[model samples]
Target: MERRPRRRLLLHGLVGLALLLADLPALASSLAAWRITRQGALELRTSPNVSLQAFFEAGTRLRGPRVWVDLPGAPSRTRSIRGSGDVREVRIGRPTPDTTRLVLEFRPGTELNPADLRLVGTAADRWRMDLRGLSRPVLLGLGEGDIEGSATVAYSPPAPFPTSGAPLSADGLPVVPRDRFKVVIDPGHGGPDPGAVGIGGLRETDVVLDVSLQVARLLQARGVQVVMTRTSEVDVDLPPRVALANRVGADVFVSVHANALSMARPDVNGIETFYFSSSSSRRLAGSLQGQMLAVSPGSPDRGVKAGRFFVIRRTVMPSALVEMGFVTGGLDSPRLANPAHRRRLALALAAGVLQYLGGR
Candidate 1:
């Protein structure tokens, strides 16, 4: 009887221990590292398990511009790092017991536009906040009326193309009016970022650059004002590219890139285009996808997709990102490598833009 009682007591103690373990909270995530890039952007690396929530707030004369990033379920901690240019300092603190916060402080008299500040990265743990290439004045005089005045800018629709005497391009598409329409062409990757490398040692940066240049020439010849994100070999971060388009008030923004897959799967190849929110962007993507498929009948039609890519999401104007074809694919590699085929592809893309503009 004494042995049975002891055995029951041991079983109850084991059950109590499991209940205690189950009631305990999970381990909190943390910031792994952080640094400022040469381009004057703040880059933060978080623990792989962290999910970030961030926002920017405009500052006044008393305080500086600030950006707050919250990491939930994290412990209280305080840290600071010096910043350059517009940013004066970066601080990490605990705003709440369960939330760790990161604050970016801008220099005094600096007026940061919320649109100009962007946080971009695809990964859950890696992010970059870029404030460079701000077209607005950094310093503004403080006035009593400034607080009451409306900051909204009136929207003006683009001037319609002249119905009569509109010259037609050799491809039978209507030419855009001279100096009336602007298009920003962004070649996806360049310089240090080689993008996708595929069959026969073909580089995505090289192919996209060539096609984008050709597209620019085609558009320029048709009297459309063309702006290229990169004209040569150089690394251009995502924020500046969007900033340029927004600053210039571009009518259309298109980022050109080649898709890639594993070399072992050469069968995966297609033309696809992506757009963020907005009906205009969706229509533009659809037009581009249709035109690309019309040119390369043999290539698979991947169709238009909705994506949250930074360039397309941040640009104020209608934007699309086009993936020409897979670099690793058996069929796409040879065509992308050929100069004449690239020209054909460029013509198709240009036609798509013209088609959209004309319809609009």
Candidate 2:
């Protein structure tokens, strides 16, 4: 009987050993063998101050089930860096035992295009994540794809622009000026709020203001009454800007802004437009998008989208926000920095407005 008990214990121990041997594969796979580092953080002095980066050793296959961009200024109490341009902090964490996530925080008034993130494999065993070519706060994450596909896939523009139906009634129709049409033109981010800073220290406010003024002049030449939110360099709040459009009872409202994307992909250049995600604004948005593309032949067609921007949302009439070109783009930056290119952008904006108003 004593021998039987001893044999029983031996069998149990053998079973446990066998199970552990069988689990060796899984245990080995789960081991955190990959080396990760924030090595790119040292090069934060570059323009737009691409302040942070994460690097992973080769063979560390990444699979993200959740990736996104968080635009609210960095969490107030979290670990952070101050005044390194638009980016405030880069936080890394293990949301789960097996998952590692990188979160980028930005200062207020910064923006990021998820597609601008460029993940490059620098060596046989090293991959680098770069954050550059941007002057705004943007959040980007990767999910369910190879590294390259992850970020670009996040920028899924709408497939098609919606068309407008017949005008329901005279009261519902866009207002027409006695002689032609009237429009409210808003140049976004002025004075203190520089909106987005791009390559060679080009400020979004300066570019947009210049374009807005030129658009105003072009519209006036075509017999359209143009009411500008701010005629010169000055700060204009969102509420007051919308209030001016509503007060004038303009037929249509158009806000101008220059686009900024992640510095990693300086090649991403294009023009895009946003209207409220409502059917009422689609037709105008579509017209503007189509006309602008027609004038700028080589520019990438980013398509019209429904955005919940304050100015467009608050305005009573049909409204659209125009993102002329990428100020951080290699091709677009030089073009926008030049006076002739600014005039072309102005012409495109004016033409789009005129087309939507049936003035073209």
Candidate 3:
């Protein structure tokens, strides 16, 4: 009887070990590497074999300004890496058996605002945190309790378009006639993705869609061929938006979006535009910025910037992404909610597109 009991226990132990071994691959995710990009942002890369699940919590801790990234299911490990710019060092440790923690220590006197931190990536395997546009640092005395803030994850890489289309050339450039000038206007976010919520519960999706529709209408009135990525409140991924423009051989691609900051920053308001590659794209961005500023009185001109947003980057044509104004701004929210104001903004956008095309 004793021998039989021992044999049963041995069998149970083997089964348990086998189950643990089966789950080892899923739990083997770890911090593979990290580097600071030319933009002065911190980029973190995880093991690609498994999906990454990380929770970032940042604030002024009792010790100082710090950010804690918790990785559940990660193994216990201790390591430290030197940091650049405002970050003094990054320390990796196992806070609990099931949780791996990454502590980011900032230089003394660094004013860490959660709003300035933006985490963007398509997959968890690679993520980038932008901290270059931080406001001037201020000395907040240590032990001021926790000034809590959360980082916003934005943007994703473009996926392949769902439906089959005409095959592209060897260079991945679509073959189409350039006889007529074509434009594609994409309104950012819709349906399930309400985008940034602003003052009085104003949604970014609704605002941008209204502005884009008016823009398309005005452009059509001028006898220009216009294509819209979305005409109603429905979800459209970044891939199809870019594919449509490329397949049709559009001359220009413009995406409309509204800016947003924390609710605490009601005073922060501005108009900015983004473009990727080519001097022609830069010119388009400049034209849009100027016209929008001319009509949007009292709104600060945030200028044109280079951004690698999926829609703007993947499109073959000269493209620009315009952030009309801050939806969270005290001044901008009311104006954006007004149909007449949106109409004026639309007119300015249409005029900007015409201006760019005219110069071509």
Instruction: Report, for every candidate in turn, its global Cα lDDT versus the true structure.
Output: 0.67, 0.53, 0.63
Candidate 2 structure lDDT: 0.53
lDDT of 3 by residue, 1-360 (tens): 000000000111112110000012425435555555445555665443122223334434444366555444554457777665666677877776655666667766666555454443322244455654333432222111122222222212122211112221112112233335778888886544567889999999888888877776666656567777665454445666777788767899999999899999999999999999889999999999998998899999999999888888888889999999998999888988887788778878888888898788
Clash counts for all predictions: 0, 7, 0
Report the lDDT tens digits of candidate 1 across residue range 1-360.
Answer: 000000000111112110000011325635555665555555665543234556666667887767766665565457776666666777878777666777777777775556555454323244466665533322222111122222211111122211112232436655666677889888876544568999999989888878777777777777787777665444445666777789778999999999998999999999999999999999999998998888887999888999988889889999999999999999998888887778778888998898888778
Best by TM-score: 1
True-vs-predicted CA distance for residue 123, candidate 2, Å:
56
* TM-score to true structure, per model: 0.55, 0.50, 0.52
Tell me, by lDDT, which candidate is best: 1
The model with the greater lDDT, 1 or 3, is 1
Candidate order by lDDT, highest to lowest?
1, 3, 2
Looking at candidate 1, what is the lDDT of residue 286?
A: 96
Off by over 4 Å in 3: 1-179
The ten-residue window of minimal lDDT in model 1 covers 1-10
In model 1, state the lDDT of residue 258: 93
**How do the residues 178-241 of candidate 2 rate in per-residue lDDT, one tens digit apiece?**
4467788888765445677789998887888777777776666566777776554444456666
Least accurate 10 contiguous residues by lDDT in model 2: 1-10
Candidate 2 lDDT score at position 298? 86
TM-score for predicted model 1 compared with the true structure: 0.55
